[model samples]
Target chain A: MPDTAFADPDAGLSPAELAARHGLGFAGTRPTLGGYARQLWAYRHFIVAYSNARVSASFSLTRLGRLWQVLTPLTNAAVYYLIFGVVLATRHSTPNFIAYLCTGLFIFVFTQTVAQAGVASITGNMGLIRALHFPRACLPIAIALIELQNIGASMLVLTGIVLLTGEPLTWEWLLIFPALALQMIFNTGLGMFLARLGSKMTDLKQVIPFVMRTWMYGSGVFYASSLFAEHLPRWAAVIVEANPMLVYIELIRHAMLENVKLSSTLPHLWLLAVVWALVVFVGGYVYFWRGEQEYGRG
Target chain B: MGVAEVAERPAEAGQRIPTVIVDDVHVVYRVQGPGTPGSGSPVAALSRMLTGKRTPGLREVHAIKGVSFTAYRGEAIGLIGSNGSGKSTILRAIAGLLPIEKGGLYTAGQPSLLGVNAALMNDLSGERNVELGCLAMGMSKADAKKNSPSIIEFSGINERGDFASLPMRTYSSGMAARLRFAIAAAKKHDVLLIDEALATGDARFRKRSEARVRELRAEAGTVFLVSHNNQSIIDTCERAIWLESGEIRGDGPTADVIKEYQQYMNRK
Candidate 1:
């Protein structure tokens, strides 16, 4: 044996003293909140590049390539239109139901995709997480960005469809940008929150689709908010109307269609939209960062 | 050298600053039943989901059971062990990739693991992956762009004609490993962990990588190389740590530790 002489030479010193002397501290220690924010900001370029690459690579294998971004949602709208409009005769009850349905489908899918992708962000990038060290939030943020890009592409198709459905190009249509932007912030927050949650409970992956489906139904994606007020209990009606997704979907529909009537029960939709966006964005971000050191662990 | 000569050696010979201090660190992996979802029926899974009770049977795998070591700057340490002996786990723990279940690890700077397989995307072209890898390692876009040519040249993938332009999935395993090693080696790290990065390289490439590791160490960095190839360990490292079943069997000069490890392996 070589005497093992160097073993624990700093045994006599306190941890703080040892840290000061050797320029070391506990490994995997969570950075300070401000430091964490700075580190994340430094990685902004990587997040953007990663999101762009994944968005482009996502469709590379398909023949339609990037066109699928637009086509997938349109196809979904057509399927819902056939079932809800023709089979269920929902269009007879709601005026300009094609435009209304398309707006709802396009907007709802944007949030849905963001949530789903966010849940998978950490679980999907296990290889990268296990191999390299960076802010784990980057994965979820990148997923949200990918959804944002996809929604941006799909919006072009949405604009054309709204025009085809006889909704005039009024200045109110400009409100769509703010509506989408608010939803983006809301979705990004939800994505960050879910990313941390999904990393801990793999079972969340199985439950998300069902949860999103219920959320879609409650958000009045295929129907009007008035249906809830007319049929459901008073408390249930408030829950449906207060849902942030419904607020966004209603906002977009109002922006796109000049004749679409706003329900009397829905109050202060714009203010609620902004408040929900800010609350979720800040809350989810902090919630996700709190678990930063716990991610990628067995 | 005898034990006395080794003992007389200065503890802080080349560089006095301790780059890595792993103080009685332990890492446990909670492997869910059989590493897959249980064979329960979909109805059972659904019922469990509905009840919000997702309790999978848990088993703890103690990958590193209280390993302690201090690595100083300008030192290259070799970690040698049989399969699943926790060599890679230790490197990962030091890199902060694995959470230490007990004790603590302190480091001077972020430890970079030397393997591109985790950082680079297979669907991306090698050229794009190089740029992305550089950016992921904290290099600015301009620096990544400027360094791409040299990274490609160092990896030697382009020698085969347009390999850099091809998607990484098209490359052979060796080609991929070489490219990954090149990308990681392109930037200087304060602490570098090499987990079998040299195992896939050819003889010439391995020699080049060995020289590069030495160059890195000479620049006042600590390096931990986990490799099964004993010769590479002996050649590239001055000290060797022999671990068996998540415990260090021996730690000393490279030749002495390797000799003890080889004997232990032969007896097995």
Candidate 2:
């Protein structure tokens, strides 16, 4: 498919001979994505470095600088709470609904940010990708670093949420951090998938807002997953419980919420998170690599 | 008339021993129709796709077609052609940006297409793009930091002194182009592709840049340059390829190809 790969010159391309010249940080090859994964990890430094530049520069001109990172989300959560907490007064079985909503919303926002940006990642960075010879995966991973910057501020915001709610913590609270990390890995993988899809068909860009909105609501950000316990069928219930985000948010509240129960879904949640991460991480990676030669043509 | 003939030939050749082989790399693209101002419905995209009326937006244009060449270690090749004659396309394809359909392209080193691709950010200071460029070129962070000062000085932008900190966007087009050329030229690669960007800088910078290209060649690097300025190509390149309609009409001594190309132009 030389013609096929090269067919779309103005759009969709891998780096021009990037793997040939720079070696994408691997020697030899394997049948699967082991090569690509290792390459992504090796390119992690590039991701961090570039991400630092983008995040800092993106905010540099403003008066507040990095404070905008914290402020933007803090404001977003405040806006949501004022509407949902005070105006709507949506009560829940889960006490301290403010913290519950904030915790779930913050993590859910991470997934949304990555998804919104991820689809356009490779396509948008066409200029950088074309000129410089490096791993294609670095584009998506680099974007994650932007979210990682948000993590620090968001965590601070979360801790503040906890303080306001007065939720006691146990050792299980420690799991929140790792859960956040796993969620990020999952997000990165999904980002990779989106990068590939977005590069292929820009319609993904159009569909993204609707998709993220659906995901946000279904993720139980407003109330609790427990709200759906009666209406959803057994399989549907199982499916929602299996959502990696649900697991993390539920786990977060269990750890932080005042006297919340640890759902039997913990092992299932951990398994689901790992599997989702690896599946998207590895699956999206393989799909993206199969188009390696295609990236240069675009 | 049959593109299939040329496209099929490469498959018959050796499949996977890469020195720098591009076989029959043909890059064809579709012109997406301009969105018609329709009755305001979001389904306009679907409706457009459903229309089977495919008008060739323009004629089928060939950027690079059936162009074949081989370069060994230590060989410097020049590509000379009329505007839109596919000289830059050839370089981009060799750099793996375009695909060819009618021939084979082989080179030893991964090419850095050093013209349009060589450009740096104008929003940030020249220094930032330099760091980004060096890193993008795959230099380690420490190495990029180490080499950045030398690259800046090598670019002669530092001689402009403190004004260099001003965003490149503020600089004249010439200044921005010169900084880009100097920085891309700063790093040496086994294979380099030079587009016409070198003509932007002052005389002294051009001479220094020429010497750098020569030095890279002396170090056994392969260089492919695309330029309309015949004098520079003849002066710098021992060999040249003349392209017409994305086809290499002539490939041999720089003088032979340039002379033939000139004759074709004069006759027309």
Say which candidate scores most in DockQ. 1
> What's the alpha carbon RMSD for model 2?
7.7
What lDDT score belongs to each candidate, Candidate 1 first? 0.83, 0.69
Candidate 1 lDDT, tens digit per residue, A181-281? 99999999999999999888877988899999999988888887678879998987777777899999999888888767664333589988999999999
Candidate 1 lDDT tens digits, B1-268:
2322122224453325678877777899876654346636677668866898754555688999877766777778999999999998898888888888888789888998875456578878999889888878888888899999999988889887999988888998988999889888889999999999999988888888899999998778888999988989889888888777888778778888788888889998
Runs in model 2 with CA error above 4 Å? A1-32, A261-264, B1-23, B30-44, B48-61, B99-104, B117-119, B163-166
TM-score of 1: 0.94
lDDT: worst 10-residue window of model 1 chain A: A1-10
CA shift at A187, candidate 2, in angstroms? Answer: 1.0
Question: What is the DockQ score, from 0 to 1, of model 2?
Answer: 0.22
Worst 10 residues of 2 chain B by lDDT: B1-10
Could you give the CAPRI-style class of model 2? incorrect
For each candidate in turn, the TM-score is 0.94, 0.85
**What does the lDDT come to for candidate 1?**
0.83
Could you tell me which 10 consecutive residues in candidate 2 chain A have the lowest summed lDDT? A1-10
